[model samples]
Target: MSTSLKIYDTTLRDGTQGEGISFSVTDKLLIAQKLDQFGVDYIEGGFPGSNPRDISFFAEAKKLKLTHAKLAAFGATRRAGVKPEEDAQLRTLIESEMPVLTIVGKTWLMHVHEILRTTPEENLAMIEDSVRYLVAQGREVIYDAEHFFDGYLDNSDYALRTLEAAARGGASNLTLCETNGGKLVPEVHKIAAAAVARFGRDKVGVHCHNDSGLGVAVTLAGVDAGASLVQGTMNGYGERVGNANLVTLLPNLFLKMGRTANCAKNLKELRDLSLFFDELANLRPNPKAPFVGQSAFAHKGGLHANAAQKVARSYEHIDPALVGNRTRVLVSDMAGRTSLTLKARELGIELDERLPAMKGLIDELKEREFRGYEYEAADASFRLLIAKWLGQQKTFFDVENYRVIIERHNNQIWSEATVKLTVNGEAMHTVAEASGPVGALDKALRLALAKAYPQLQTMSLRDYKVRILESNQGAGSRTRVLIESGNGKKIWGTVGVSDNIIDASWEALRDSVEYMLMQS
Candidate 1:
């Protein structure tokens, strides 16, 4: 029988520390419940004494009747001079009443002397007293030996003494941490093997960081060397370069190694789990992340797509459905007849082999791509391209003419935009004034379209990103604008490119309205 590994998730605690990520108490509770449903062994909610939100999250998590996972409250070990029983932080950690408690203690001599301004012996005493106090309070304590890898390399005897203190203090587990995240795979294996040899396998754990981009590799090396518990955050959110990403590590442990880890929850739900957090955090999901990314299974080369169609194992490592992703054949200039036919079939469009329109559309896409229009990132434009080629697109209104006026008056700027549009053979004109040219144009366009398409009023731009394509200097700098719009249930992205920002924004806005109408 394969041994089941423990999955310790720190998304609530460490993930929120990621730059620009903040979660409310309710958000923390939701993530905790979802992680429970996903079969994680433990959920580290947050450090209770660190912030008011975290303190509230601990109180809120206590009220939840979690079915499978144990909630862990996190905090630092006691101060150098104070006893664990006397330290307010340690007392607060106990008062949180979580079933599990994780306390980080200094392991590196540099941190002891420089950061903590304490003697090495005092640091060891803090670890010992904190673990004993938490354990004595009926809490399962996991002592995180912060900077254990570096500490071991610096002074093997002192690092070993720290682990011995936690063990002697009845800590349920001693987690070796890579604080700076610079340890290579070989160094990880060597240190982990030595720690296991000294502490025995059951008492050891691994907490990795990603500063050097080796978190995942180092984590795997730790497990291979004999770690019973692996600690990391989902999507690798943390202070600096982020913590180790367990989303990438779990599948490698369970699927690749064929080790049983009790992850009976739908492994296919990994993608949704990843994206759900991204949405809540108001961040764009990384498209290149392994297993759950948008392009994880996307195939583009003609030879690769043909091989993938024949036997997915030829080009793909495994079936994407195993992780709840579908194989995609991107339509681009490199797409051959086989790739095009597959794309059409997936879209429910039947194309005759000899259709001139099909070839013409492919040629147009190639020509446009060379001119700075990227269809891959702009699915709205790609869909419109297909609809136009099929003669199935409907234009609710035609824009006859538009002009933007910018004037400088008395050391201030004034802007006005006017749009003349024809809707169903009736002409309408609207004018709007704003602080800037782009805002004025948006107001005018919305006012003109609102009369005809009432649904357009419900839709708004959620995000707008601009990128310059060619940087050949002032006169000929080609620019592209990617606009993301939402109508609550679905999000659509459109792209527009031109020398003028107003023109690009107008093109993207026009596509947005058209896409919404198609949805309706």
Candidate 2:
């Protein structure tokens, strides 16, 4: 068998099926180009003629000059009884001018009869005619035998017939889909081998869902059975649980399974690509998600940190740097000096391992922990604190006084804020308005220092999160604020804890600005 495998990505199409996952036309085009950069074989542009957004996305996507990855327009076979050429969906697929058109057709007889409202033979005819029509139109077709696993389990002979029909119609590939994601690895192994026996090994593909949390396992098992194409989405964003997570799957296939694919040559971009898509969709990157997640290579336990520092593979599966991620030693209750030193080293802190100050730092961290401050999720703040302790930190400006006024009038809420600050003994005051006191205060602070730092033009607050810490004095409870700031090229999180939410936000906001300046 050839070691080469074809990687088909459905992030733009099937990925949007995931709840709260959406991409604008521009976002779709950018992702397509990134996918091309990542060296995937194909990127499905979504089902054209189904919605205005998809239609617009295909138009813009076709304009991008991709280096790798074929642009594929997705659609179903012609309606129950219609010519593929005259059908609007198929016609739109052709008009999109994508290099390929991926068409799904009924495979399970139950779907053919019940959902499609057509006889089993008619459904077969639809598959054959649609693939043939697209082929005749000079478009490469990948026939998706949707529900193939379930269909094969219910009616093996009929499911095999569907693949044969698509093959006769000139489909370049026949993909077996675990539609409901209910198939286990053993079932995938068995059914995929049968698919190869019936349709030959050259063109069989595997597409799976994550309902059973075994999408990647099942896909690998199918590959073991000689299926050459792996269909999935980045981070497994799809309907229900999700599609197989390409973030985890691709690295495994290349490093462990030794499967040759385009992306294998560019493993370094894997983590960046995964986070890029998540940020674009305004979704929080899953901390516990497989290979590309934040926690993938994070070590918290003292023993694990010690062993990992000496020999990384002791606690890590691979050198995280190979995938554009680094081993992160987290500071937690289970952490020791090793963890602190590892984390401090990341921020360029050169605290001596044997120094007595090491224990003092640890004590300080524990005291802060008791004060409702968490550093695990806010490294930027931790770094700033470390810099301050080492006397390496700089203060560009000092806040002397700040006030915010919020009131309701004319049935609309209004807020204004003022800040008094000093830079190098010179005093300055600025005022601004926003929908909320935090925004107004942030604006006021920035306006005050706008003249001192112009690079601030490139940065913006990405997200703001607030949580109330439990206290015996309920009315005087303290709050913790976490602010995510991004400079278009990178993002960092800072933390603040105080009795007043405004004070907490200001602390985080100040740290965020200081962190960015320190980098600049």
Predicted candidate 2 versus true structure: per-residue lDDT over 1-520, tens digit per residue: 3389999999999999999999988899889889999899999989887889997887777778988789999989999888877888888889999999999988898898889999998888899999999999999999999999999999999999999999999999999999899889999999999999877877899999999999999999999999999999998999998999999898888888888898788999898998999999998898887778889899888889989999888899998888888888888666678888888887777677787666767788878878888888788988887776666789888889999999899898878999999977889999999989988988998888888888888889888999999867696899999999999998899999999988999899999999999989
Clashing pairs in 1: none
In candidate 1, what are the lDDT values of residues 105-197, reduced to their tens digit? Answer: 988899999999999889888889889889999999998999999999999999999999999999999999998999999999999999999
Q: Candidate 1, overall lDDT?
A: 0.86
Provide the overall lDDT of each model, using Cα atoms, as 2-decimal numbers: 0.86, 0.89
Model 2 global lDDT (CA atoms, 0 to 1) = 0.89
Looking at candidate 2, the ten consecutive residues that score lowest on lDDT are 349-358
Lowest-lDDT window of 10 residues in candidate 1? Answer: 257-266
Point out where model 2 deviates above 4 Å. Answer: 57-64, 81-92, 391-405, 415-434, 443-462, 471-474, 486-492, 513-520
**Model 1 clashes, total count:** 0
